[model samples]
Target: MGRWEPDARGRLLRAALELFAEHGYEATTTAQIADRAGLTKTTLFRLFADKREIVFQGQGELLALVTRGVDEALNDASAWDRMVNGVLVLSGAHAHEHRTTGRILDPILARSPELNERAVFKRSAITSALEGSLIGHGIDRWQAGALADLGIRAYYSGYDLWVAVDDSSTLADHVLAQITVLRGAAAQALEAAAPQPHPAGVRSADG
Candidate 1:
């Protein structure tokens, strides 16, 4: 029997990232990842579906956290508020501890088209989870979808900012800054798209 190991999933993820960075993602194998993590292949398979899964682990937990954050928001919270709450909740759980992993994983994904595609799927899943939560809580589907897109965009852009810089600011702080930028951009878009009244003396060709 194998002795108990704490944080096996995290260990496996870190090991996989380290290996993929040192070697290449395509050259790496599950057996090697398990071995690097100091566990058997069976243990790795128990935790992940396959080698690709190791790269995309913790998604279930993140989706659950997003739902929890949205659900826990005040009943009267706006859609933006609910989405921000979810981003905050998810980011808080990750925080600065995941930076090293991010720094390694980013380049790995960039170099591999397969991993990049998987990342997009994971991103969509999270957005859908957030959207569903908002709609379940009485938000209109249109608004929920739009807010989910915006929120996810902010979340990822914030993560990139966090990983690229060496700063003491938390992930939540970065996410909030991105949220502010997105909100301002959205406001500007709305204003630009709104109809502008013409001067009384100005008659259009169509008129």
Candidate 2:
């Protein structure tokens, strides 16, 4: 192996995923990942904080995309539009490319409590960034938070389905589909919960 491989960071990430899937996330070590990548542990450490960081290497880029999407949304856009736009940006930025990695990481996450917790934390951070960006765009804080949460839910639900299914649709398409479904469901639930009006020309029993 050459001392300087092209795309060393990518090589490290792929190597880590392979190791994690083969030996479980909790069982894999930074040294093993480095060795698998044909790089020294120092090289791996330089590229990533640790083994866990390797799985979440795309976190910063995804969050940045969401922030930029929300910031650039039209001032008059609805909260749902702003939130969906951010999610679409994130999906477009890395969804297809990260799908395989996500598939590989999913089982590992399910087997490890620490990694699962970290994954949840990363998701929360992404939602926080989305909410902050929406708030900066003049949306109410509460609405922004709710929109961000819904966006995150849509993204994850879509990503999971996309990875699990044998479909050709892009990640952005899957996310949009999930968002539409979620919106419809929410509307249905709200309608079901709303108070029914009295019959025409008739008063309610209490009235």
Candidate 3:
């Protein structure tokens, strides 16, 4: 693709965000977004299915990147390691790309329940893709589903924290850190749930 081709999509995305911020998501029309971008409605439609699609178009690419990462991981890697690797790959692919767009998009999503629902669906799609990849690598289906959920949760948490901070670490580093935190929490919960012996001198409250 030409340099200008990428610019066209960026322009439309930015224009749509601005209009949504100024008016409202429901009030902002595709024609206005195209006009703001200095492109025709036809050109806008060529790049996106609709206004919602413009906001979510990158999700498909992210899913593909994560899936490729899972597929190419070392054969001996554990399921959790493979999931983390996929998230790291996704972070690398989108680290610097979405900061500005996210600043604009987050508030818009919060304001509209429709947008929020769509965002949840997009996240679910990513988790589903990751689960499928894990299953293909020979992991049990149920365990793979749980690991995928964890990976996606870590990804979004890390992404939010990374974009909000002015840290020197890369997005992948933040993602790994989030995954570590989640793992620690899970371990602690498991430990707490394990049965423990009562002290010899201790009496039960009921006794």
RMSD per candidate (Å) reads 1.7, 1.8, 3.0
lDDT string, candidate 3, 1-207, tens digits: 332455887788888899999998999999999888888899889889899887787788888988998987888999988998888888888656576677778889989988898999999999999999999999999999989998999989988887787757677888899999999998999899997878999877767
Best by lDDT: 1
Residue 144 lDDT in model 1?
96
lDDT of candidate model 1 versus the reference? 0.90
TM-score for predicted model 1 compared with the true structure: 0.94
Candidate with best TM-score = 1
1 or 3, greater by lDDT: 1
Query: Runs in model 3 with CA error above 4 Å?
Result: 1-6, 198-207
lDDT of 2 by residue, 1-207 (tens): 674878888888888889888888878889888888889998888878888888778788888999988877788888878898899998888646677777787888899898888999999999999999999888899989888988999998988988887667888888899999988998999899999987799998887
RMSD, candidate 1, Å? 1.7
Compute each candidate's TM-score over C-alphas.
0.94, 0.92, 0.90
Q: Could you give candidate 1's per-residue lDDT for residues 91-194 as a string of tens digits?
A: 88885669878988899999999999999999999999999999999999999999999988999999999999997988888899999999999999999999
